[model samples]
Each structure stands twice: as structure tokens, then as C-alpha cells.
Target chain A: MNARAIDVRGLNKSFGDRHVVRDVSIAVDTGRITGFLGPNGSGKTTTLRLLCGLLTPDSGEGTVLGMDFRARGDAIKRQTGYMTQKFSLYEDMTLEENLAFVARVHGLDNRRERVEDTLHRLGLFDRRQQLAGALSGGWKQRLALAAATLHQPRLLLLDEPTAGVDPKARREFWDEIHTLAAEGLTVLVSTHYMDEAERCHDIGYILYGRLIARGTADAIIRDSGLVTFLGEGPGIDRAAHLLARADGVLSASAFGAAVHVSGLKREALEAALVPWRKEPFRWSEVPPSLEDVFIQLMGRERDERYTS
Target chain B: MTGSLPRILAVLLKEFTQLRRDRITYAMILVMPVMQLLIFGYAINMDPRHLPAAVLSHDTSTVADSVVAALERTGYVDVRYLPRSDEELDQLIRRGQVMLGITIPPDFTRRLLKGERPQILAEADASDPQAAAGALAAVSVLPTEALRHERLGLGAPRSTAPAFEVVVHRRYNPESRSPFHIVPGLLGIILSMTLVMMTAMAVTRERERGTMETLLSTPATPAEIMVGKLTPYVVVGLVQTVVVLGMARVLFSVPMARTPAGWLALACGIVLFIVGNLSLGYLISTLARSQLQAMQMSMFYMLPSIFLSGFAFPFLGLPPWARVLGEIIPVTHFLRIVRGALLKDQVLADMGNDLLALGLFVLAVAGAALGRSRTTLD
Candidate 1:
């Protein structure tokens, strides 16, 4: 069997009286992409930091690339490349200069050749002389990706790498990530976009510092056991509000000109939609989507953790 | 550690390249001290000559002429105008036209002939009371001229003799060459100011740019990083010391009686002390959130050092409480050591206490900085 690229268990962290991460565990296979999906401040970034040795957990036992996470942090750091959410490059320097600085910092041999190759691979060779600050968001994202991969680390830990990137740019970024994964680079990326999460081999959904669900996109949707019905009409906003207050309705949210109503009990969801069926609104029972399952999961979890 | 050598060298090279790009910093590093030396070297004058004075001769006789000649002979005073009226003399003193105004009464020649003692009126500007005191002593010498003629029996009656005598002794800086006093202290201020400001800002800039974290994650330990950052500034400090000392010799003619090697060694020690102070500043920068706050804190420390370090003012003349406060500053001890070695040709034995104080300060500050850098948080 191939060794796991990341294997960690029973991770916990607390800041003052608040537990930021609680008993979280996850594993990603070698050369596979795993998505960490959550809302803001949902322990996703903290977990990523813990995995990459950027932060030490209060109580945890984990091995990253066969090295102990706590004791061999330096070794782990040397073998992993972390790209932070913010644009953390020297803004005054040109694109080529920024990349060359990272290369030299890593003490990589053939630095000039490596920098040329990385820039060319990112399709940024034409704009190599442009100052980093002057580049558009898309080009800046490309530069960050190139700098992250210049050292060729085995594992890549990315924290919300596509937060402010446009849809087209984000799609291109995901394509490049997949290409890197195909070359046997293990990637663990956290993202808020559902489409980005769907592209992952497996997904972990965290809420309020707790892992609520984990599986493939299809399995997470299937195993959630939620029955969702869509109501299409001109006045769906009132219907969504009324259905949200209705009995047995797990979650109701608007999704692009349609209101998707979901409940764990199929009969109850159908009964809740029965009142809206007499008007111009049309209700159709459909298979639950990943968004529906996640919304229902989020509805079931508390907004904050309670300690007894 | 061996594998990280190339990486450390790369970081050093990158820092140097970035420093080169910052032309303002380059100019500050190279030009500021020389300009300060040239300007301040001329501005500070301890030995002042050619003070303006007014002479009032109530008797226009040879004795009064002799008195005027005596005052002119001293070369310390320049008799600007002989006022015809005493009110004019008072006006000259009030307007600051003359710092000293002397009056010879009409009975001055008759008093000398009758053997009655006559007092000469000498009024002076007492704003800078010390300046007036020096002028007063100089004016008293004029009466000695009259006595000298009487003793020689050439131009004065033999019956007239001076009843009392006055003697003057100048203290502290006898020759009053400003450079002798200023250059030694300027060396301390220049080294501390440049080293602390530059190193503090440089370290803070790295942290601000997120490069410090990159360096931390490397195989280089905190100690290695600190040493690498400090080494270049030490070299710069040594070069500045040499330039300042050379300028003092060429322009101000300040002499150094000790061997060149001894001076160099002392300067190296001072530079080390400065580097240690700058390292402490870097530790402060790490705690600060912005460049402005770092600069403010540096200035806060620098202002007191300039005032209390005995560089601009005499440490001994300060009040007891001020002196006690001044002793806490490293620059205070550094100024004392530099001036003692350069001016007095003081050997290490004579400066054992100052050397010990500087050594302890360096170790304490360097250790604190290293300790602070070891922890990730402020």
C-alpha cells in the first residue's frame, strides 16, 4: 500500500476559553487533491497550519510524509510549500525578480534556469518585467503559484488560494492545481467555492471548529439523506420565508432564481411544500445537491459550541 | 548547518542588493556623518576671541592712554568706540555692542600722584555669565600696565603703586579648541545614531515585507540570522569611524598621540558596542507593528542619549539627578571612553571602569535581543 501523504488524528486547539479546533482528524492520499470547505473562522486555516507545522496543536499526534509533526517540523517545512491567502510577495520588485529571490532563498542550484522554466510554465514569461504590484489579480495569482512550486516540495498546503480571484481565473488555477497533482504532488487546499470543492477527490466540511461531514462530493450528498424540493415562481422569497418557519423544514435558501427547500424527512419536506403548490409556484422533488446537504448540515450544527 | 551556508549567503547578497536599490538609505549611510561633522565642527567654538568693548576716558592724559593701550595689548578685547558720555557707554552695554565697558575717572591721574587708591569702573554683559567673568579678568590686566610703567619709572610717578593684586586661571578647556572637545563626543553620537537607526529600520522592513518568516523557516537558526544581519552594519560603523577621525585630523587638526593600532582597537570596541545597541533596537522593532512606531521609539531613545550622554554638555556639570540618569545610557560610557582614549591618551587600565560598563551593556542588550528573537511573539 502507498503511504499516506498526511495522516493526523485527535487534533485539538484552544485560545483562552474558546476551542478553535476540537478533535479533528483527516487524511489525504499521496498525489491526490483534497478540499477543506468551511465558512470563515471555521478551523479550516488552523487545521491547515497544524498540518504544515506552521502551528503546533495543543494535543495531537500526526505524521506528515512519515515524519512526526511535532518533533520534525523543520523537516516537514523543508518538504512542504505553503501559499498564504494574502499576496505576500515583494510588491516593488518585478515578477522575475520575486521568483528569483524565492529561488535563491531556497538555495536551489541553476536558479536562473529554474526561474525561467517556472515563469514559462505559468505562462508569465511575457510579463516577467512587470512589477508585482502592477499586475492584475489573475497574474498575481499565477506568480504566487509559481513561487510556491519553485522549490518543488512534495506537499502543497494552500489556504484560500482563490478567495478574491475571478471565476475564470479560479478555474484556470484549479486546472493548474490538477496538473501539479497529476505529477505526484499532494495538495490540500481550503476553499469557500462549492465548485472548487466538487473538483476535489474528497471533501471535509467543518463548522464551528468541528468536522460535520467528510466524503466524496457524491457520497456527501447521498449520505446526507436529505430530500430537497425546488419552488420556482415570481414570489419565491415569501415562500422561502414561510417554508423556513414551517414545521420539519431543515433548511431553505435561494439558489439562482430558484428556492431550494430541504428536509431530512422526505414526507415532511413534501408536506411543507404542499401549501405553495396551489398558487403559480411549481414544486418538483429532486436529488439533493452538495450545497443542499451542506446547508442542511450547517442548519443542524450550532452556530457556536456549547460546553457542559 | 553546512548545507545552509549557501542559503545564508544568498540572503546576505539579497539584502545587499536591496540596500543598493534604496538610494536614500545609501546616501544617508555615506554622506550624513561627513556633513554633520563639517557643519558642527565649525558651529561649536569654545575659544572665542575679539570680544567688543567700550572705553570711557574721563581724563585724556597719558595715564588714560596708557590704560587704553594696556586693554588693546591683551588682544582678548577689541575697543570698538570710546564713548564721550557715560550714558553712551551704558547704551553700548545694553545693546550688546560691547560686552565690557571700562571708565577711567577724572581723578584717576591725581589719585595716582597723591598715593590714594582709585577704582576703575568696568561693567560687562552678564547674560553668558561665564563669558563676562572671563572678560572681567582680562580687563583687570589693564591696571597692571599702569603699575608696570610706575615700576619702570618711565611713564608713571614712583609714589603711586598698586595696593591689591588679581590673578586669573582658565579651567576645563585651556586652549579652547572646539574640535578637541567636540570630535570625541561626535564619534560616539554618530556611531550610535547611524547604527541604531539603520539596523532597526532594516530589520523591521524585513519583518514588514514577510521575508523574516521566510528566513525563520529556513535551516538558519535565529542566532545565525541575527549575526548575519549585524555583521554588515559593524563594517559600516568601522568605516564611518575611520572617515570621521580622518576628517577631524585634516580639517580641525585634532591630534592623536597614541599608536594607530590602539585607536583602531578602541574604535572597534565602540563599534561593537554600537552594534549591540542596534541589535537591541532590532528586538524593539520586532515588537513594533509599523516603521513609524519603530522610528518614534528610536528617536525617543536617541534624544535622551544626545542630551544626557555628555556629548553636547559636560556630564560633571549636570545636576546629581541628571548625572544619575545619564549614567544609565550606554552612549554616556562610550563618550567617556572615546574622549578619554583619544584626548588623554588613556590606557586600558585608566578606563577599566568605562570599558567594563560598556562591555556589560553590550552583553545585556545583545542577550535580551537574542532572547526576544528566539520567541516568535513580541
Candidate 2:
């Protein structure tokens, strides 16, 4: 078997005049969970859709599940599961009915047993008779996940699976994702949350229809070349706005009582922090976080857009 | 292919569940056909009676008075106006006050007594030909009846053959009942409007509800999706057929196919016509982006089908181009099959062209619908 569940190159997709996914290439290994982080309309969802057979690329050449994806879309679709950003299951159907539908669509032999097992495993058995539309936001997503994975697909693609979900529910959802990945199911998920990015085995940050930074969370932060400083004082949080507009400051923001300022050059960052470095204020060089690196990356892309 | 049946069943069950949950679709399915049947069956009349007419008689003789009296006994014309001149009668007819006019000349009684064969001119407003046909036919038989009555008093021999006699045999509908003509055609029309609109909204509803993306992401093929989604609706269409046909039989007393073979032919035609309409609606769903757009598109299709497909008008009466256009609509061929099998007792063997046309329509429209259906979001 191939080590990668998905191996694709030069995947291009466009809607009318807007080129949404531009020359994107990605490779995801089996049994690993990969997270995609990007701003809205950055092609993260489009790239996820293209990997599965949910969308046809304008121009692409790749093999998904050891077969040519474009030529053998039906074959690829059978092995792939996609959960849309929205609650895509039939809102009018009961939870049990939705899972049964997915199971039957995949032609599972033990449809009832599988639906029962999934409902119980997801802790949704108690409310299986309720209409899916009546479920809370977190439960709706959990049901969506249950339906997507009901067929035991080799690869699972989730688009913003927890947008409006609470922190506890999101954590539980990630725990379930990790448990599935440990059993050798490949997952590619997209989200706007930084904590979710930290939970992934690998991360890809997209900007303006292009995948710009890709690595483990720690490695991406290290490779971003962003130097960050922590400043703490009585009113140091107010200096975030002033330092954000400085020459070398890429991003400056207040985190409760302390303010974090990041830049590419250490001297430039230190020089920008000079005003708040007086009397009671204490300054220390700290490691750049994933969010700080992503913010810097977005600022860099914005500068590139203006200059070019 | 092995998984096709299961996938189709999955879609069929899902559609059924949603339909059961939707109260609006249930109301539409039951109420729309019966309401339209009542409105069209009871309210509209193609053959009218007791039409208003104007009579102007210049001769005040007994012969002229008896002729005028003979016109009213036909039950078609009601002589309500006694205009003084031709211009007054013309004004009454032109302004839509009266439908017919009768004028007696000055020398009518003298000419009739001398065997001059004087003419009593009868004029009709022929703008609505259906309304005028019965009234004018009544006037034509008047001369013979009145002359036969006059011969008894004049003492003339009744052995000689009078003028020409017209013997018309109106087959199937001797009484010219409007319901007999309209009810069978209503079957075609009701199926076209409801089946097309229902199926057209099927796929678009998924798209609008954002479930289409998830559906496309599954292992289901386009063929599987189409077959699965359409099967439940096919049952619905069949039930509607039974409803409309039952109402036609019980309420309107419309005749049905006589022999077993003829009934089979009707059944086959009905199935083909339902599938054809469902396929056309699926094709519209592929073209439309929303349920509203699907409804609008179904309406756009229904207008031409109702007008050009011999449902509301006579098929042969249309212009050549319109007749050619009517031949393309599935309702046209289906109407022919229905009217033939029910009223004329035509079997499958007798209606080869119409059945073949309906069969070809199903194949062509189903092929187009499947071709246009997308397996992917693109």
C-alpha cells in the first residue's frame, strides 16, 4: 500500500473569473490528521473538496487511493468521505435515518447494526429519534461526523466541522478524530481556530488561494522568522496599537494584561518596544506562537500584494 | 452496478421521509387535482344555450309571425330584441348584446304563396365559432319544418321530395357533452403540471438546503441518484393518475377503455407519460438553481403544453407550426392515447404512432436528464 492516502499536484479550480484553488499540491499520509488554517475564501475548503471527488478540478493530475483521481472518480468517491462546512445532513430526517441513509448509500451489508453502533458510539442513541435540525450546534456537527464516517471510508475530509461549537465540544470532537486516525483513517480538516491547528499532526496555512506555510505547528512557527517580545506593565496593553504601526512590527496585540509584539528583525522589534520598556514595564524575548506566525504571514502577503 | 439498488433505495427512503414530513407537499398532492377538476368540470361550458338574438320583421303577415315562432322552439335562440331596422340589429350584435339576427323582407308571404321561394336572411356573430355553430344549425332546419306545416293548409301534395337532408352521426359523443371531451384531456394536463413540478423541485431542494454537496460526496453515481430520487415520485404520479381517472369516471361519467387490451394500452401510456414528465422535470432541476426557479421553469413548460397539446383547444384547429410544436410535447401524445382508449375504444395496436411517440419522448427526456445531472459540484 502507498504511504500517502492522497498524493496530488498542480490542482487548479476556478469559479467564473475568480480562481479559487490555484496550483495547489498536497500529500497526506495514512493514519495522520492534518489541519488547514486560512482566512475566509483562502481556498482551504476548495482544496479539501478537490481532494475528494466532491469537485472536479479545472486542471490537475494526481492519484487518490493509488488510482488516478480524475479518471477514476467513482472509485475514488467510494473510499472518500466528505463533511461540508454547513450541516449537510437532511434536517428533516431523524438522526438514525440520516446515518442509515449514508450507510445504504455506501452499500454496507449490516446497515442497521452499523447505524446502531455509530449512534451508540457517538452518544447520540438517546436522541436518535429526534429530527437532525432540532439538534444543538455541537450535536449537529457530531451527527454530521457520524454520517460521514459511517461507511468506513479510507479518507475523511471535514470542512470547518466545528465553527460554532463550544470549546469542550470541540475538544471532544478532536479526541474522536484522533481516535479514528489511530485506527489508520486519513483525515484532512480545515478550520479558523488556532487551538485546532495545534491538535493536528501537521498544518497547512493558506493565503489568497495558495498554501503558504506547511509543517508541524512548532516547525511552522520556527520557520516563520518572526521574533516576538512579551511586555507586562500596568498599561502596557495600550501600547499594542502604537507598536502595531511601527516600522518592523508585523503584529502587535494585547493578551489580557500583557502585550505581545512580533517582527522579523529582533533589533527592530526591540527598538519599537522602547517606549513601553520604561520604569515598571518588563520586556523579555519569547518564542513566537502559531497565531503570531500566521498573523505575520498574513501581513507579509498583504505587503506583497501592495508592492507587486 | 452491484451497489446501484441499495443507493437508489437509500434516496427513495430519504425522499419519502421528507415528503411525509412536509405538510405543504401533501396538501398540494391531494387538493390541487380535485380542486381543478371541480372548477373545470362544473364551471366551464363549451356548448352554450339560450343565446340572445334580435329579430326585425318588415312583413306583419301570419307566415312571418309563425317563422319567428319556429326559431324559438329550437331551444338554441332566444328572441329578446325586436329592432326597428337592420342598423339597430347590427348594433345590438356588434356591441355583444345579441349573438344572432333575423330579418324578414317585405314580400315574404306573397312570394311564399306564389311558390317564389322567398329568403329569410339569418345572420350570426361568428366571432366565437363554438357558440354560433348550434344556433346557426337550428336556423337551417327551420325552412323545411315551416314549409311542411304550411302545405297542409294550402292543400298541396306531400309526396314530392323536399330540399336536401343532412344526416350527421356524431360518434362516441352523440350528445356533444363537454365533459366527455374535457375530462380525458384533463388527465394529461393534471399529470403534466404536478409531476413535472414535483420532480423538478426534488434536486433543487437539496441544493438549496445545502445537502447536495454532501450527497455528491458519497459513492452514489448520477444514475443512482436520479433513479432513487424519481422512484417515489413515480408512485405519487401514479396515485394522482388514479385519483383524476376515478374522479373522471365517478363525477363526469366519462367513458373508459372497453376491452382488456385497451385498458392495458391506457396503463402503458399513463406510465410512459408520467415517466416522461418526471424526466423533463429532472432536466429542469439540473438547469435551475433554486426551488423557485424550478417552479417557474415548470410553469414555463406547462403553458405551452396546455395550449398547444390539444388540452384546451382542438389539435387540428391549430396552425401548422403550432401543430408541429404540439407533437413534440409529451402531453399531446398522451392526450391522444387517453382520448382514443377511453372514448374511441382504441387499443395499443390501434394507437401505434401515439404510443411510439410517448415511448420516444420518455427515452429522449430521460437521456437528457441523466446527461445533464452532475456527479460533482462543478
TM-score of chain A of each: 0.95, 0.98
**Stretches of model 1 off by over 4 angstroms after superposition:** A303-308, B1-174, B202-220, B235-243, B256-258, B319-324, B347-352, B374-378
Best by TM-score: 2
Looking at model 1, residue B173 earns an lDDT score of: 31
- Residues A145-240 of candidate 1 have per-residue lDDT tens digits of 898889898999888999888999999999999999999999999998899999999899988888889989999998998888888888786667
Best by DockQ: 2
Docking level for model 2 = medium
Q: Ten-residue segment with the worst summed lDDT in candidate 1 chain A?
A: A299-308
Instruction: Please give, for residues B245-301, the per-residue lDDT of candidate 1 as tens digits.
Output: 889889987666387655764764576567667776777666555676566567666
Which residue pairs overlap in candidate 2's backbone?
A: none
lDDT of 2 by residue, B1-378 (tens): 987999999999999998797664565567657745743454334555567777788877766567667778887777889899988876666444566787788887666665656677777654334555666776777767655676557765554443223233234565667788788888899999989999999899999999999899887888999999999988998899899889989998988889999899899999999999999999989888768768867876886688777678655444556668779999988887887788767678666888899889889989999998888787
